[model samples]
Target: MTDLALLQALGALCVEAGRAILDVYDAEAIVVRSKDDRSPVTDADERAEEILHAVLAKLFPGVTVIAEEAASRDGAPTEAPETFLLVDPLDGTREFINRNGEFTVNVGLISRRAPVLGCVHAPALGATWIGAAGRGAFKAEAAIRDVPAPAAYRPIAVRQRPAAGLCAVASRSHADAETEAFLEKLGVVERRSAGSSLKFCLVAEAAADVYPRFGPTMEWDTAAGHAVLAAAGGAVTRPDMTPFDYGKAEAGFRNGGFVAWGARD
Candidate 1:
Protein backbone atom coordinates (compact mmCIF):
# COMPACT_ATOMS: atom_id res chain seq x y z
CA MET A 1 0.00 0.00 0.00
CA THR A 2 1.09 3.58 -0.54
CA ASP A 3 2.29 5.37 2.61
CA LEU A 4 -0.89 7.42 2.76
CA ALA A 5 -2.98 4.31 2.37
CA LEU A 6 -0.86 2.56 4.95
CA LEU A 7 -1.74 5.26 7.45
CA GLN A 8 -5.45 4.97 6.79
CA ALA A 9 -5.30 1.19 6.89
CA LEU A 10 -3.52 1.31 10.20
CA GLY A 11 -6.24 3.74 11.23
CA ALA A 12 -8.75 0.97 10.64
CA LEU A 13 -6.65 -1.29 12.87
CA CYS A 14 -6.67 1.38 15.53
CA VAL A 15 -10.46 1.45 15.40
CA GLU A 16 -10.63 -2.30 15.86
CA ALA A 17 -8.13 -2.12 18.69
CA GLY A 18 -10.13 0.63 20.32
CA ARG A 19 -13.26 -1.47 20.21
CA ALA A 20 -11.44 -4.39 21.84
CA ILE A 21 -10.08 -2.15 24.55
CA LEU A 22 -13.52 -0.75 25.21
CA ASP A 23 -14.95 -4.25 25.37
CA VAL A 24 -12.53 -5.23 28.10
CA TYR A 25 -12.80 -1.80 29.64
CA ASP A 26 -16.55 -2.15 30.06
CA ALA A 27 -16.42 -5.66 31.43
CA GLU A 28 -17.17 -6.32 35.07
CA ALA A 29 -14.47 -7.05 37.65
CA ILE A 30 -11.55 -5.90 35.54
CA VAL A 31 -8.21 -6.57 37.21
CA VAL A 32 -5.22 -4.24 37.25
CA ARG A 33 -1.68 -5.33 37.93
CA SER A 34 1.53 -3.46 38.63
CA LYS A 35 4.64 -3.71 36.53
CA ASP A 36 8.12 -3.60 38.02
CA ASP A 37 8.09 0.17 37.75
CA ARG A 38 4.79 0.23 39.61
CA SER A 39 2.85 1.40 36.59
CA PRO A 40 -0.52 -0.20 36.11
CA VAL A 41 -1.33 -2.86 33.51
CA THR A 42 -4.52 -4.61 32.60
CA ASP A 43 -5.81 -7.49 30.48
CA ALA A 44 -7.02 -4.94 27.99
CA ASP A 45 -3.47 -3.78 27.31
CA GLU A 46 -2.29 -7.32 26.68
CA ARG A 47 -5.24 -8.43 24.60
CA ALA A 48 -5.18 -5.31 22.47
CA GLU A 49 -1.45 -5.63 21.89
CA GLU A 50 -1.86 -9.25 20.89
CA ILE A 51 -4.51 -8.42 18.33
CA LEU A 52 -2.58 -5.45 17.01
CA HIS A 53 0.62 -7.41 16.50
CA ALA A 54 -1.22 -10.16 14.71
CA VAL A 55 -2.89 -7.70 12.38
CA LEU A 56 0.27 -5.68 11.77
CA ALA A 57 2.36 -8.75 11.05
CA LYS A 58 -0.20 -9.84 8.49
CA LEU A 59 -0.40 -6.39 6.95
CA PHE A 60 3.37 -5.91 6.73
CA PRO A 61 4.93 -9.30 6.61
CA GLY A 62 8.51 -9.52 7.98
CA VAL A 63 8.19 -6.17 9.75
CA THR A 64 9.23 -6.49 13.38
CA VAL A 65 7.46 -4.70 16.21
CA ILE A 66 8.27 -3.16 19.55
CA ALA A 67 4.96 -3.70 21.30
CA GLU A 68 4.63 -2.64 24.95
CA GLU A 69 2.50 -5.48 26.21
CA ALA A 70 4.56 -8.11 24.42
CA ALA A 71 7.78 -6.57 25.63
CA SER A 72 6.38 -6.39 29.15
CA ARG A 73 5.28 -10.00 29.09
CA ASP A 74 7.88 -11.81 27.02
CA GLY A 75 10.75 -9.47 27.81
CA ALA A 76 11.97 -6.73 25.46
CA PRO A 77 12.54 -7.63 21.86
CA THR A 78 16.07 -9.04 21.85
CA GLU A 79 17.03 -6.98 18.87
CA ALA A 80 15.80 -3.62 17.57
CA PRO A 81 15.54 -4.08 13.83
CA GLU A 82 16.22 -1.17 11.54
CA THR A 83 12.60 -1.04 10.32
CA PHE A 84 9.75 -2.20 12.51
CA LEU A 85 6.38 -1.39 14.03
CA LEU A 86 5.92 0.51 17.30
CA VAL A 87 2.70 -0.23 19.11
CA ASP A 88 1.30 1.03 22.34
CA PRO A 89 -1.93 -0.88 22.46
CA LEU A 90 -3.29 0.70 25.58
CA ASP A 91 -1.86 4.07 26.37
CA GLY A 92 -3.71 5.00 29.53
CA THR A 93 -4.04 2.07 31.88
CA ARG A 94 -4.51 4.43 34.80
CA GLU A 95 -7.28 6.26 33.05
CA PHE A 96 -8.69 2.91 31.98
CA ILE A 97 -8.66 1.71 35.55
CA ASN A 98 -10.07 5.00 36.71
CA ARG A 99 -12.71 4.67 34.01
CA ASN A 100 -12.09 8.26 32.94
CA GLY A 101 -12.17 7.21 29.27
CA GLU A 102 -9.06 9.00 28.04
CA PHE A 103 -7.10 5.93 27.01
CA THR A 104 -5.99 5.29 23.40
CA VAL A 105 -4.58 2.84 20.87
CA ASN A 106 -1.38 4.10 19.19
CA VAL A 107 0.19 2.54 16.09
CA GLY A 108 3.23 4.10 14.45
CA LEU A 109 5.28 3.42 11.37
CA ILE A 110 8.91 4.44 11.73
CA SER A 111 10.83 4.35 8.50
CA ARG A 112 14.62 4.74 8.46
CA ARG A 113 14.47 5.93 12.07
CA ALA A 114 11.81 8.60 11.56
CA PRO A 115 8.09 8.65 12.15
CA VAL A 116 6.52 8.43 8.68
CA LEU A 117 2.88 7.59 9.30
CA GLY A 118 0.67 6.92 12.30
CA CYS A 119 -2.76 6.79 13.93
CA VAL A 120 -4.18 7.30 17.41
CA HIS A 121 -7.69 6.18 18.30
CA ALA A 122 -9.64 6.82 21.47
CA PRO A 123 -12.74 4.66 21.19
CA ALA A 124 -14.68 5.63 24.25
CA LEU A 125 -14.02 9.26 23.49
CA GLY A 126 -15.01 8.64 19.86
CA ALA A 127 -12.03 10.60 18.51
CA THR A 128 -9.15 9.69 16.20
CA TRP A 129 -6.15 11.45 14.69
CA ILE A 130 -4.50 10.05 11.59
CA GLY A 131 -1.51 11.43 9.66
CA ALA A 132 1.21 10.64 7.17
CA ALA A 133 4.36 12.46 6.09
CA GLY A 134 3.72 14.76 3.10
CA ARG A 135 0.03 14.39 3.95
CA GLY A 136 -1.44 16.69 6.59
CA ALA A 137 -3.22 15.52 9.72
CA PHE A 138 -6.92 14.67 9.99
CA LYS A 139 -9.50 13.83 12.66
CA ALA A 140 -12.49 11.47 12.39
CA GLU A 141 -15.35 11.00 14.78
CA ALA A 142 -16.17 7.32 15.36
CA ALA A 143 -19.87 7.96 14.97
CA ILE A 144 -19.39 8.76 11.29
CA ARG A 145 -17.78 5.42 10.40
CA ASP A 146 -21.02 3.96 9.06
CA VAL A 147 -22.08 6.83 6.80
CA PRO A 148 -21.16 5.69 3.30
CA ALA A 149 -18.10 3.87 4.63
CA PRO A 150 -17.03 7.06 6.49
CA ALA A 151 -17.54 10.75 5.66
CA ALA A 152 -16.30 13.02 8.44
CA TYR A 153 -12.74 13.75 7.41
CA ARG A 154 -11.48 17.21 8.35
CA PRO A 155 -7.98 18.55 7.87
CA ILE A 156 -6.19 19.49 11.09
CA ALA A 157 -3.40 21.94 11.76
CA VAL A 158 -1.48 23.35 14.70
CA ARG A 159 -2.50 26.55 16.42
CA GLN A 160 -0.51 29.45 14.97
CA ARG A 161 -0.87 31.54 18.10
CA PRO A 162 1.95 33.71 19.29
CA ALA A 163 3.68 32.45 22.42
CA ALA A 164 1.39 34.33 24.79
CA GLY A 165 -1.17 31.84 26.09
CA LEU A 166 -0.09 28.33 25.32
CA CYS A 167 -2.47 25.45 25.94
CA ALA A 168 -0.37 23.03 28.00
CA VAL A 169 -1.05 19.34 27.39
CA ALA A 170 -0.33 17.13 30.35
CA SER A 171 -0.55 13.55 31.58
CA ARG A 172 -3.63 12.52 33.48
CA SER A 173 -1.77 10.17 35.77
CA HIS A 174 1.92 11.11 35.71
CA ALA A 175 1.56 14.73 36.73
CA ASP A 176 4.30 15.91 39.03
CA ALA A 177 5.24 19.08 40.87
CA GLU A 178 8.29 19.57 38.68
CA THR A 179 6.26 19.48 35.49
CA GLU A 180 3.77 21.82 37.12
CA ALA A 181 6.62 24.22 37.94
CA PHE A 182 7.76 23.95 34.34
CA LEU A 183 4.29 24.83 33.11
CA GLU A 184 4.36 28.02 35.12
CA LYS A 185 7.11 29.30 32.86
CA LEU A 186 5.14 28.79 29.65
CA GLY A 187 2.20 31.14 30.26
CA VAL A 188 -0.12 28.17 30.16
CA VAL A 189 -3.82 28.83 29.58
CA GLU A 190 -4.76 25.74 31.60
CA ARG A 191 -3.80 22.12 31.91
CA ARG A 192 -5.34 19.93 29.21
CA SER A 193 -5.46 16.48 30.75
CA ALA A 194 -5.29 13.34 28.61
CA GLY A 195 -4.12 9.76 29.05
CA SER A 196 -1.39 8.01 27.07
CA SER A 197 0.12 9.60 23.98
CA LEU A 198 -3.21 11.24 23.28
CA LYS A 199 -1.59 14.38 24.73
CA PHE A 200 0.52 14.47 21.59
CA CYS A 201 -2.60 14.03 19.43
CA LEU A 202 -4.19 17.03 21.12
CA VAL A 203 -1.27 19.18 20.04
CA ALA A 204 -1.15 17.59 16.61
CA GLU A 205 -4.78 18.48 15.87
CA ALA A 206 -4.62 21.97 17.42
CA ALA A 207 -7.46 20.85 19.65
CA ALA A 208 -4.95 21.68 22.37
CA ASP A 209 -1.33 22.87 21.94
CA VAL A 210 2.11 22.42 23.52
CA TYR A 211 2.79 19.22 25.46
CA PRO A 212 5.94 19.32 27.59
CA ARG A 213 6.65 15.90 28.99
CA PHE A 214 9.55 15.73 31.43
CA GLY A 215 8.89 12.27 32.71
CA PRO A 216 10.26 9.08 31.22
CA THR A 217 8.99 8.09 27.77
CA MET A 218 10.38 5.53 25.39
CA GLU A 219 10.79 6.09 21.65
CA TRP A 220 7.58 4.23 20.85
CA ASP A 221 5.66 6.68 23.00
CA THR A 222 6.31 9.69 20.78
CA ALA A 223 7.19 8.41 17.28
CA ALA A 224 3.67 7.89 15.92
CA GLY A 225 2.22 11.06 17.35
CA HIS A 226 5.40 12.88 16.49
CA ALA A 227 4.82 12.08 12.86
CA VAL A 228 1.23 13.29 13.07
CA LEU A 229 2.10 16.56 14.76
CA ALA A 230 5.07 17.18 12.49
CA ALA A 231 2.97 16.52 9.43
CA ALA A 232 0.32 18.86 10.82
CA GLY A 233 2.83 21.74 10.82
CA GLY A 234 4.04 21.27 14.37
CA ALA A 235 7.45 21.07 16.02
CA VAL A 236 8.92 18.44 18.33
CA THR A 237 11.86 20.15 19.93
CA ARG A 238 14.20 19.37 22.75
CA PRO A 239 13.75 21.18 26.05
CA ASP A 240 16.25 23.74 24.80
CA MET A 241 14.23 24.04 21.56
CA THR A 242 16.39 21.87 19.33
CA PRO A 243 14.57 19.57 16.94
CA PHE A 244 14.19 16.10 18.45
CA ASP A 245 16.64 13.38 17.43
CA TYR A 246 15.37 9.81 17.41
CA GLY A 247 16.99 6.47 16.49
CA LYS A 248 20.24 7.44 18.12
CA ALA A 249 22.32 4.42 19.10
CA GLU A 250 23.01 5.64 22.61
CA ALA A 251 19.38 6.38 23.40
CA GLY A 252 18.43 2.81 22.47
CA PHE A 253 14.76 3.55 21.73
CA ARG A 254 14.43 5.98 24.60
CA ASN A 255 13.25 9.60 24.36
CA GLY A 256 14.01 12.63 26.44
CA GLY A 257 12.18 15.85 27.34
CA PHE A 258 10.68 17.39 24.23
CA VAL A 259 8.02 19.98 23.48
CA ALA A 260 5.42 19.08 20.87
CA TRP A 261 3.51 21.98 19.35
CA GLY A 262 1.20 22.26 16.37
CA ALA A 263 2.86 25.35 14.94
CA ARG A 264 6.46 25.14 13.88
CA ASP A 265 9.41 27.52 14.28
Candidate 2:
Protein backbone atom coordinates (compact mmCIF):
# COMPACT_ATOMS: atom_id res chain seq x y z
CA MET A 1 0.00 0.00 0.00
CA THR A 2 1.00 3.60 -0.46
CA ASP A 3 2.55 5.40 2.49
CA LEU A 4 -0.33 7.84 2.92
CA ALA A 5 -2.91 5.07 2.84
CA LEU A 6 -0.82 3.04 5.29
CA LEU A 7 -0.74 5.99 7.68
CA GLN A 8 -4.49 6.40 7.43
CA ALA A 9 -5.06 2.72 8.13
CA LEU A 10 -2.69 2.88 11.07
CA GLY A 11 -4.46 5.96 12.38
CA ALA A 12 -7.77 4.15 12.33
CA LEU A 13 -6.25 1.22 14.16
CA CYS A 14 -4.79 3.59 16.74
CA VAL A 15 -8.19 5.20 17.29
CA GLU A 16 -9.69 1.79 17.81
CA ALA A 17 -6.94 0.89 20.24
CA GLY A 18 -7.41 4.25 21.91
CA ARG A 19 -11.12 3.52 22.32
CA ALA A 20 -10.36 0.23 24.00
CA ILE A 21 -7.85 2.00 26.25
CA LEU A 22 -10.37 4.69 27.19
CA ASP A 23 -12.90 2.06 28.16
CA VAL A 24 -10.43 0.80 30.73
CA TYR A 25 -9.29 4.29 31.64
CA ASP A 26 -12.81 5.48 32.36
CA ALA A 27 -13.72 2.46 34.45
CA GLU A 28 -13.68 2.29 38.22
CA ALA A 29 -10.15 1.06 38.79
CA ILE A 30 -7.34 -0.07 36.55
CA VAL A 31 -5.88 -3.38 37.65
CA VAL A 32 -2.14 -3.24 37.33
CA ARG A 33 0.43 -6.03 37.25
CA SER A 34 4.16 -6.33 36.68
CA LYS A 35 5.89 -7.90 33.73
CA ASP A 36 9.06 -9.94 34.08
CA ASP A 37 11.03 -6.72 33.63
CA ARG A 38 9.13 -5.35 36.66
CA SER A 39 7.46 -2.68 34.57
CA PRO A 40 3.78 -2.15 35.11
CA VAL A 41 1.18 -3.62 32.78
CA THR A 42 -2.57 -3.33 32.72
CA ASP A 43 -5.57 -4.84 30.98
CA ALA A 44 -5.61 -1.78 28.78
CA ASP A 45 -2.09 -2.39 27.48
CA GLU A 46 -2.67 -6.02 26.61
CA ARG A 47 -6.13 -5.51 25.15
CA ALA A 48 -5.06 -2.64 22.96
CA GLU A 49 -2.09 -4.63 21.73
CA GLU A 50 -4.29 -7.61 20.95
CA ILE A 51 -6.59 -5.43 18.92
CA LEU A 52 -3.68 -3.87 17.02
CA HIS A 53 -2.08 -7.23 16.35
CA ALA A 54 -5.26 -8.70 14.95
CA VAL A 55 -5.90 -5.81 12.60
CA LEU A 56 -2.28 -5.60 11.52
CA ALA A 57 -2.06 -9.31 10.81
CA LYS A 58 -5.19 -9.06 8.71
CA LEU A 59 -4.17 -5.85 6.97
CA PHE A 60 -0.59 -6.76 6.11
CA PRO A 61 -0.15 -10.47 6.25
CA GLY A 62 3.54 -10.62 5.47
CA VAL A 63 4.95 -7.63 7.29
CA THR A 64 6.77 -8.47 10.48
CA VAL A 65 5.01 -7.26 13.59
CA ILE A 66 7.00 -6.31 16.65
CA ALA A 67 5.07 -5.10 19.67
CA GLU A 68 5.97 -4.14 23.22
CA GLU A 69 3.86 -6.56 25.19
CA ALA A 70 4.64 -9.38 22.80
CA ALA A 71 8.34 -8.65 23.01
CA SER A 72 8.19 -8.73 26.77
CA ARG A 73 6.44 -12.08 26.64
CA ASP A 74 8.18 -13.70 23.69
CA GLY A 75 11.49 -11.87 23.39
CA ALA A 76 12.83 -9.49 20.77
CA PRO A 77 12.91 -10.50 17.12
CA THR A 78 16.24 -12.22 16.62
CA GLU A 79 16.69 -10.79 13.11
CA ALA A 80 15.65 -7.40 11.83
CA PRO A 81 13.50 -7.20 8.75
CA GLU A 82 13.87 -4.56 6.07
CA THR A 83 10.27 -3.53 6.69
CA PHE A 84 8.05 -4.05 9.69
CA LEU A 85 5.29 -2.61 11.83
CA LEU A 86 6.10 -1.60 15.41
CA VAL A 87 3.36 -1.09 17.93
CA ASP A 88 3.45 0.31 21.41
CA PRO A 89 -0.26 -0.21 21.80
CA LEU A 90 -0.36 1.70 25.04
CA ASP A 91 2.66 3.82 25.71
CA GLY A 92 3.09 5.37 29.14
CA THR A 93 1.52 2.60 31.12
CA ARG A 94 2.64 4.35 34.28
CA GLU A 95 0.88 7.55 33.23
CA PHE A 96 -2.22 5.59 32.34
CA ILE A 97 -2.16 3.84 35.69
CA ASN A 98 -1.86 7.26 37.34
CA ARG A 99 -4.91 8.47 35.34
CA ASN A 100 -2.92 11.16 33.59
CA GLY A 101 -3.91 11.99 29.99
CA GLU A 102 -0.39 12.00 28.58
CA PHE A 103 -0.28 8.42 27.33
CA THR A 104 -0.67 7.43 23.66
CA VAL A 105 -1.19 4.55 21.24
CA ASN A 106 1.69 4.49 18.80
CA VAL A 107 1.73 2.72 15.38
CA GLY A 108 4.75 3.01 13.17
CA LEU A 109 5.67 1.50 9.79
CA ILE A 110 9.37 1.01 9.31
CA SER A 111 10.80 0.68 5.84
CA ARG A 112 14.45 0.13 5.15
CA ARG A 113 15.21 0.60 8.82
CA ALA A 114 13.48 4.00 8.92
CA PRO A 115 10.01 4.99 10.02
CA VAL A 116 8.13 5.96 6.86
CA LEU A 117 4.70 6.55 8.30
CA GLY A 118 3.18 6.75 11.76
CA CYS A 119 0.10 7.55 13.84
CA VAL A 120 -0.01 8.59 17.48
CA HIS A 121 -3.34 8.67 19.27
CA ALA A 122 -3.88 10.15 22.71
CA PRO A 123 -7.24 8.61 23.47
CA ALA A 124 -7.90 10.36 26.72
CA LEU A 125 -7.10 13.73 25.18
CA GLY A 126 -9.21 13.10 22.03
CA ALA A 127 -6.33 14.01 19.76
CA THR A 128 -4.44 12.09 17.06
CA TRP A 129 -1.37 12.94 15.03
CA ILE A 130 -0.45 11.36 11.68
CA GLY A 131 2.58 11.79 9.46
CA ALA A 132 4.31 10.24 6.46
CA ALA A 133 7.63 10.94 4.85
CA GLY A 134 7.45 13.96 2.49
CA ARG A 135 3.74 14.32 3.33
CA GLY A 136 4.13 16.54 6.40
CA ALA A 137 2.17 16.00 9.61
CA PHE A 138 -1.19 16.94 11.18
CA LYS A 139 -3.16 16.84 14.45
CA ALA A 140 -6.92 16.64 14.94
CA GLU A 141 -9.49 16.06 17.62
CA ALA A 142 -10.98 12.61 17.07
CA ALA A 143 -13.40 10.68 19.17
CA ILE A 144 -12.90 7.06 20.20
CA ARG A 145 -15.17 5.58 17.55
CA ASP A 146 -14.49 8.21 14.93
CA VAL A 147 -12.34 7.49 11.91
CA PRO A 148 -9.93 10.12 10.63
CA ALA A 149 -11.29 12.46 8.00
CA PRO A 150 -8.95 14.66 6.03
CA ALA A 151 -10.67 17.96 6.76
CA ALA A 152 -10.57 17.37 10.50
CA TYR A 153 -6.77 17.54 10.62
CA ARG A 154 -4.71 20.67 10.39
CA PRO A 155 -1.25 20.53 8.84
CA ILE A 156 1.60 20.94 11.32
CA ALA A 157 5.29 21.71 11.08
CA VAL A 158 8.12 22.37 13.46
CA ARG A 159 8.65 26.01 14.27
CA GLN A 160 11.80 28.05 13.95
CA ARG A 161 13.74 28.52 17.18
CA PRO A 162 12.27 31.41 19.12
CA ALA A 163 14.52 34.35 19.87
CA ALA A 164 13.97 33.87 23.60
CA GLY A 165 15.46 30.37 23.90
CA LEU A 166 14.61 26.73 23.46
CA CYS A 167 11.57 25.13 25.10
CA ALA A 168 12.30 21.54 26.10
CA VAL A 169 10.14 18.58 27.12
CA ALA A 170 11.12 15.48 29.07
CA SER A 171 9.54 12.23 30.19
CA ARG A 172 7.43 12.83 33.25
CA SER A 173 8.22 9.39 34.69
CA HIS A 174 11.78 8.92 33.43
CA ALA A 175 13.38 12.30 33.97
CA ASP A 176 16.74 12.04 35.72
CA ALA A 177 19.76 14.11 36.65
CA GLU A 178 21.49 13.35 33.36
CA THR A 179 18.49 14.50 31.38
CA GLU A 180 18.40 17.69 33.42
CA ALA A 181 22.09 18.23 32.76
CA PHE A 182 21.56 17.68 29.04
CA LEU A 183 18.78 20.24 28.94
CA GLU A 184 20.81 22.67 30.94
CA LYS A 185 23.76 22.24 28.60
CA LEU A 186 21.43 22.81 25.66
CA GLY A 187 20.56 26.24 27.11
CA VAL A 188 16.92 25.54 27.52
CA VAL A 189 14.68 28.44 28.47
CA GLU A 190 11.80 26.31 29.64
CA ARG A 191 11.40 22.68 30.61
CA ARG A 192 8.10 20.81 30.66
CA SER A 193 7.08 17.29 31.60
CA ALA A 194 4.94 14.89 29.59
CA GLY A 195 4.44 11.15 29.44
CA SER A 196 5.08 8.71 26.60
CA SER A 197 5.68 9.75 23.00
CA LEU A 198 3.76 12.99 23.38
CA LYS A 199 7.05 14.69 24.14
CA PHE A 200 8.17 13.85 20.60
CA CYS A 201 4.84 15.07 19.21
CA LEU A 202 5.34 18.33 21.10
CA VAL A 203 8.53 18.94 19.19
CA ALA A 204 6.93 17.58 16.01
CA GLU A 205 4.20 20.19 16.16
CA ALA A 206 6.50 22.88 17.49
CA ALA A 207 4.81 22.97 20.89
CA ALA A 208 8.32 22.46 22.24
CA ASP A 209 11.75 22.96 20.71
CA VAL A 210 13.71 19.93 21.89
CA TYR A 211 13.42 16.70 23.91
CA PRO A 212 16.59 15.10 25.19
CA ARG A 213 16.22 11.52 26.38
CA PHE A 214 19.16 10.13 28.35
CA GLY A 215 17.45 7.10 29.80
CA PRO A 216 16.52 3.80 28.18
CA THR A 217 13.83 3.58 25.50
CA MET A 218 12.84 0.81 23.16
CA GLU A 219 12.46 1.39 19.43
CA TRP A 220 8.71 0.97 19.78
CA ASP A 221 8.78 3.76 22.35
CA THR A 222 9.97 6.33 19.85
CA ALA A 223 9.45 5.19 16.24
CA ALA A 224 5.96 6.55 15.63
CA GLY A 225 6.71 9.88 17.24
CA HIS A 226 10.04 9.97 15.48
CA ALA A 227 8.27 9.61 12.13
CA VAL A 228 5.93 12.45 12.97
CA LEU A 229 8.81 14.66 14.06
CA ALA A 230 10.81 13.86 10.96
CA ALA A 231 7.88 14.59 8.67
CA ALA A 232 7.31 17.91 10.41
CA GLY A 233 10.85 18.97 9.51
CA GLY A 234 12.36 18.04 12.85
CA ALA A 235 15.11 15.52 13.58
CA VAL A 236 15.94 12.73 16.03
CA THR A 237 19.62 11.95 16.32
CA ARG A 238 22.13 10.13 18.47
CA PRO A 239 24.31 12.16 20.82
CA ASP A 240 27.06 12.21 18.19
CA MET A 241 24.55 13.68 15.67
CA THR A 242 24.03 10.46 13.71
CA PRO A 243 20.56 9.56 12.44
CA PHE A 244 18.59 7.12 14.61
CA ASP A 245 17.73 3.90 12.75
CA TYR A 246 15.24 1.24 13.76
CA GLY A 247 15.28 -2.61 14.04
CA LYS A 248 18.36 -2.76 16.26
CA ALA A 249 18.28 -6.41 17.29
CA GLU A 250 21.92 -6.43 18.33
CA ALA A 251 21.20 -3.70 20.84
CA GLY A 252 18.22 -5.76 22.00
CA PHE A 253 15.88 -3.19 20.42
CA ARG A 254 16.77 -0.64 23.09
CA ASN A 255 17.73 2.89 22.22
CA GLY A 256 20.65 4.85 23.53
CA GLY A 257 20.64 8.52 24.45
CA PHE A 258 19.16 10.75 21.78
CA VAL A 259 17.94 14.27 21.24
CA ALA A 260 14.93 15.30 19.18
CA TRP A 261 15.30 18.75 17.64
CA GLY A 262 12.70 21.11 16.28
CA ALA A 263 15.22 23.73 15.31
CA ARG A 264 18.16 23.08 13.01
CA ASP A 265 20.46 22.98 15.99
Alpha-carbon runs more than 4 Å astray in model 2: none
Tens digits of lDDT, candidate 2, 158-231 = 99999999999988998788988888887899988999999999998889999999888999999999999999
For candidate 1, what's the RMSD? 2.4
**What lDDT tens digits, residue by residue, belong to model 1 across residues 71-94?**
666666555667777888988777
Count the clashes in each prediction: 0, 0
What's the lDDT of the predicted structure labeled candidate 1?
A: 0.78
Candidate 1 wrong stretches, greater than 4 Å: 144-150, 162-164, 248-252
True lDDT of residue 235, candidate 2: 90
The weakest ten consecutive residues by lDDT in model 2 span 142-151
Q: How far does residue 25 in candidate 2 sit from its true spot (Å)?
A: 0.9
